[model samples]
Target chain A: MSRPSDVYLFGTCLVDLFMPDAGMDAITLLETLGIRVHFPQAQSCCGQPAYTSGHPREARDVARSQLDLFPGDWPIVVPSGSCGGMLKHHWPTLFAGEPEQERVVAIAARVVEFSDFLLNHLDWQPVDTGPATRVAVHTSCSARREMNVHTTSWALVDRLANVTRVVHDHESECCGFGGTFSIKHPDIAGAMVTDKARALEDSGAIEFVTADAGCLMNINGKLALDKATPLRGKHLASFLLERTGGKS
Target chain B: MNSQPVTLYPSRQFKDNARAALADTELRGSLRSAMDFLMAKRSSAFPDTDELDALRTLGEAIRQRCLSRLPELLEQLEERLTANGVTVHWAETPAQANAIIHGLVAARNGTLMVKGKSMVSEEIELNHHLEAHGIQALESDMGEYIVQMAGEKPTHIIMPAIHKTKAQIARLFHEKLPDTPYTEDVDALIRIGRNALREAYLQADVGLSGVNFAVAETGTLCLVENEGNGRMCTTVPDLHIAITGIEKVVEKLEDVVPLYSLLTRSAIGQPITTYFNMISGPRRPGEKDGPREVHLVLLDNGRSQAYADQQLRKTLQCIRCGACMNHCPVYSRIGGHAYGTTYPGPIGEIISPHLLGLENTRDLPTASSLCGACGEVCPVRIPIPEMLMRLREESQRPAGEAVDHPLRGQGAAASTTEALAWRAWRRVYASPGTYRLFGWSATRLRALTPPTQAGWTQNHVPMTPAPKTLHELVREREARRKES
Candidate 1:
C-alpha cells in the first residue's frame, strides 16, 4: 500500500542470463522511479519447470524458499511475465493447502510485474528518449491472462510520443517455450514457435518486443533456425531502456 | 469421408475411420480451413474480454452440481412434467428408448416424424429403427438435411455439414433439388434448404428435439440454436418428444443460470445465443401453438458409467459448449467423421467408447496429438487431455506411433519395434540412476543422430535429455549451497 520497505527485484532466470541488460535496466528503472530495489542473491529459478511439469511438491519446495527469502511489504518487482505469472497465478496453486499459504498470498498482493509497475503506479513524463520508432508488441499469454499487462504496457509505450506501437494480430497465441516444454516436446514446440515467428514476419514490422524472456528466447531461437529476418525479439525493459536512451 | 467397412472393436474395420481420415488429404484440408475460420470468428467476438473466465467458473460449478444428484433431479423433472399434463417416459437403454418412441408413434399410427438436429436420436439410430418399422424421419436442420440427402452422417457436432465442402453440398442439393441450380454461396444454399424443410416442419405428425439441459425443479428443457427450426419442430406438431440423457438434469432453476454463462460463450463464443428457449412441461391452458401432448424421454444409455467413476462423472457436467471441439487439434485435422461416432473431439473420445463400446472405438482416444490446447480452451476446465489419457489406458488399441510401451499385458499384441522402444524406456525410467545414465548416453549420441528419430520421431520430437539430469543438477546445487 505504502512505499515498499524494500523492493525485491526478481530478475527472472531467463533475463538474468540471456538478456542481463534487461535485468539491470529493470533494477535501475525501478530505483530511478523512486523505489528501493533489492536483488536477493539467494534467489534461484522460480520452479516454473516443476510446477508446469506437474511436479507440485518440488514446485512448492522452491516456492517456500522464495517465500522465506522475500518477506515484508516490499513490492516484488518481476520483469518477466513467465516468472511473474508463475508467482502471480501458479504459486498460490502450489502452496494452496499449506498453512504458510497465507504468507505467500500476502506476498503475491505486493508482487508487481515490471510493465505493471510503470503503467499503474508511475505517472512518468517518460525520460527524453531521443525518439520512439515503429514498434510491434507481443503480449505473452501469462502477461495477458495473469497480469493484465497489455493495456498497461500499451499506455506506457504510447506515452512516448515517437513510438508508433502496433499490436500483432496473432499476438494472443503462445510462443511455445512453455519452460522445459521446448526441449522436452520439441516438435510441437517448434511448430508453435514457427507459427509465432511467421506471424511476426507477416506483421510487416521492423521490431518485436515481449514481456517474457522465455518467449523472446524461443521466438529468437526459432527465428534464427528459420533464417527469417528484418524482425527481432527484444525484452520490454530492453526496448524501454533503448527508447529512453539509457544505453542501446 | 473415406469409405471403410464398419466392424466391432479393434477390428480390421473400425480403426480404419481415423486412418482413412488422416490419409484423406482433401477432407483434412477442409477441416483445417473450417476450424481456423470458426476459431478466428470466435476470437474476434470475444476479444480479450473480462467476461470470459468469470462465465466459465460459474458454468463449471452449476454443471457439477447437476450431475451429482442427477437421478433425484430426473424423478422431480418427471413428476413436474407429468403434472403439467404432458406424458413423460424413461428409457434405460437405446433399445428401450426406441421402443418407447415407437410405441408412442404407433399409438398415433404416425407415418412421418420431423426431426430437429438431435445428437441423441443419432446416438440411438432412432431414424433407422423407425424406417425399418415403416416410418419416415425427416431431418429439419439445414446441415442435417444436406447430410441426409447425400446418405452421409454428420462430421462435426456444431458444423455437421463441415466435412462437405460448399462445392460438394452444391452437388448434393443439385441431385436432391433438380430445379435449383448448383450454387456454392452459403446464403443461397441456406435459402434452398429452408425452401425444402419448411413444409416438413409444418406437416409431420410428431416433432423431436434433443434437450441441451433440463431443469429438474421446474421440469424445463432448454433447446438452444441459431435457427428457429427447433421451435417449429417442438411446437407445430401435435405431439413433441424431447429425448435427452439422465445426465442432462439439474436440481434447480438457478443452476441453469451459471451454465448459460459458459454455454453460449463456449458454443459460439457469444455472451449468449440468438435463441435460448426453455419449455417447462410443454403446453398448458389453451397455449396457442405448443404441442398438445409432450413427452420428455430421459434416456440413460451409458451415462451411468460416467456417474459411477469419480474422475469421469464430471464429464456429465459438460454443457456441450463445443469449445473443446472447437479447440481440439485432432478434430481440426480429421473432422468428426474420423471418430465414426455421433459425438467427436476430446470429450467425445472419452464418452463415445462407453456408448459405442471400448474395443471398436479405441482409435478416437489415440487420434490426439496431446497438445493440451483443448484442455486450456475448455470453458468448464474439464482437463480434457487428462481424460483422453485415461481413455487411452482403458483402450485395447495398439500404442500410437509416439507412445512406447515396454510391457504389453496379456491378449494385447506387442510388435517388435514397440517392444524394443518400451524396453529402452523401462531401462531408463526404472530408476533415477538409470535415467541419469541414459541422459548422459543420449547427450553423447546427439552428435551422431539425424535431425529426427528413425520412425516415431518424425511427427513428434523425442524428449531431449538435458546436459545434467534434474537430480544431478539439484544435488550439485545443494552441495554448492552447503559448501558456501
Candidate 2:
C-alpha cells in the first residue's frame, strides 16, 4: 500500500490520561513527516482491558463506539500496539456474527501500529540530532506477538545514528503489565516487573523507551517505587520525536 | 505398600501459593536458570525458523484432523487393539479408570505394580488408589522414582523431580533408602535410583505405562522418553497396563512421525528422544520376553468436554511438550507445583478447567498474563492465550445462563461487584461524551489519585494522570493550526 497523506490517531486511554505528551509527540512526529494526523476526539479506550479480561460484551460495546469515528478509509494509526492489535486482529472476532461485523473488519484492515506505520508505510529514516547516549527498548508482548511490530519499533530506534541501542536480558519477556493481570495477580506481576526493571538497569542504558504505554507505566512505576535504579522509561514515539529534532 | 497418600495442593490457593513461591529465592533462581537453559536448547534445536514453522503447521493440522474424527478414531483404536490381543477398557472418569485397572490387577492377584512415567496416573491419583487396596505401585522412571520416594507429587510432567536440586535429591535418597551414601554427582544419583528400582522391576507382578500416541490404524501404543524404564515396564513384567487420555488417538502410524518430531524437539530440544517404544499388543505365542498380558485403558475424564467445543478442542492438540511452560514468564517464577494441578503452566491453565471443574480451577485460567509466549512456542500451535481468555469468559458467565454447551463450572469466578464495575466501565467508554467527562475529571483531579491503589501500588508507585488530557492538547494544536 502507498503512503497516505492523512491518518487517524487513536491515542489510547493510557496515553490520553497518564502520558498525554507521548500522544502529542506522536502527533508531532506524524505531522513533521508531512502527514495529516487526525486525532479522533471521540475515541477513548480500545476496549482491550475489557476484552482481555473476558468481558467481550463490554469490550464490543466500547469498541463499537470507535467503529464509525474513522470512516474515511484512511489508516487508523494507533500509538499503542496492544490497542492496535485489538483493532487490527481482535475487533472482527469480537464482532463476529454481529450486524457491524463487516464494518469492524473494514476498520480492522485500516489499523496500523505507530512504528509500523512510520517504518513500513512511510519508510521513515530518522536522522539522529540529539546527544549521543545509550538507551534500551522494551517492546510490549502485544507488540511482539499480536501486532508483530516489535521489529519495526527496534528498526525505528536503530535508525537513530548517534543513539546506541542496548539489549537487555530477557528483552522479549513481558513486563507483567497484562492489563487486569497485574491487578489480579500482584505478587506474580511484581516479581516479573522487578526482574524486568533489574534487567533494564543492568543493561547499562541510562533510560528505556517502549511503544506501548502500559509497559511504560509498569516499568516506570516499578523503578519509581524501587528508587534503587536511576533508569527511567518513555514512550517510543516521544523518544523518537525528541531524537529526530522534533519538538517534544 | 503402606506408603502415605499423595498430598494435593488445591488450585484455589493459587494466590497464596504464588506468594510463597515468589518469596523463595532459591526456587526463583533454580527455575530461572532451568528455564533459561531450556529456552536456549529449544532455540538451538529449531535453528531454522522456516522449517520449525512448517513442522508446527503440519503438527497442528494433524492434531486438528485427528481431533475432528476423535470419536471414530477412538472406536477404531479399541477395535484394532482388541484384534491385536490387547484388552481395551473405556473409562469416562478417573474413578472408573482406577476401578478397571484395579480389577485387572485383582484378576492376576497382583501385589506389586512397577510403573514408568505417566501423567495420566497422577491425574487419576492411581498410586494412592492402589495403595489403598494394599497394592504397591512403584515408579521406575528416575524422576518419578525420586518424587515417589520423597512422597511428593511430580512437579513437572516431563521431569517429575525438576523442582528438586541435586543436593536435595541426594539428601532425599540418603534419608529414604538403606545404605545409600549421600552423593551430589548426577551420574552417581542416577545409578543409585536405578539400583533402587532394579529390584522392583524384577519382582513386579504387573507393570504400568503411559501412551503418547495410540494409532488406530496400526493398534500401536507409542511411548517417548529418554529413560529405558518405559521399555522395561512394558516388557519385563508379565502383565503390562498402559493408560492414557482418549484424546491421544491418532488416525495412522505415519501421522506419529511429525508429531513425535515436534514433541521431542519442542519438549527437551532433542531432535528425537533416546527411546521411542511401540507396543502393539501382548506378546505373541512365538514372542520370547515381552509381557504376556497387555491392557489399554482410555480415560475420558473431562477430555470429552474440551473436545465438545470447537475452540477449546485445540487444547487436546498439545503433544505434552513443556515448551509452553519453559517459555512462560508466570510459570518461570511460580514453578509447576504452584499450579496445584497434574499439568502445569499454559497447557494446565486451559486444560485444568475442563479436567477439574472451572469452580476448582477458576484461578488457573486467569493466572497468565496472556503474553502469547506459550502459544508462540507450542509445537502443535495450540492458541493457549486465546483459550485462557475463553475459559475466563466461561468461568465468568452468569450461572444458569442459557447456552448450548455450558462448561461444568460455568460462572464459578463471576462476581456481582466485578460485573457491576465492567458495566459502569462500559457506560463510560462506550460513549464519547461520558469518556471525555471522565478523562477531564481524571486529569484535573490527578493530585487526588490515591497513592494506595490496590495491587498496582504493591510493587510500583501510584499511577497518576497527567495534568491535561490528550484530547485537550490535540484541540489546542488544532487551534494553532487554524491560526496559522
Q: Rate the local accuracy (lDDT) of all candidates.
A: 0.69, 0.91
TM-score of 2: 0.99
Runs in model 2 lying further than 4 Å from the true structure? B1-4
Q: Considering every candidate listed, which one attains the maximal lDDT?
A: 2
lDDT of 1 by residue, B1-484 (tens): 1111122222224345555666677887787777777776667656665666666676777777767777777788888877776678888889999999998998999988988888888888888888888878888887787777777777767767888788998887777685989889999999988877788877789999998878777878889877888888898999899898888888888877767766676666677777787887666777677888889888877787767777777677776767777776556655676566778888887777667556556445545544455766677778665565456444423445333221122113324554454445444433335544655575556554456644224323343333443333334545786999
What lDDT is reached at residue B372 by model 2? 96
Clashing pairs in 1: B9-B359, B9-B360
For residues B1-484, what per-residue lDDT tens digits would candidate 2 score against the true structure? 2354687889889899899988988888888888898899899999999999999999999999999999999999999999999999989999999999999999989999999999999999999999989899998888888888888888778878777888889998888888989889999999988887888889999999999999999899999988899999999999999999988999999999999999888888999998999999888988789999999999989998998888999999988989999999999999988989999999999989999999999788888888999999999999999999999899889988988778999999999999999999999999999999999999899889998988899988999999999999999878997999
Give the TM-score of chain A in candidate 2.
Answer: 0.98
A1-248 per-residue lDDT for model 2 (tens digits): 69999999999999999999999999999989999988888998889898888899999999888877996889999989888888999999999999999988999999999999999999998888999999999999998999998898778888889888999999999999899999989999999999999999999998899999999999999999989977899999899999888973
TM-score: which candidate is best?
A: 2
Model 1 whole-model lDDT (C-alpha atoms)? 0.69
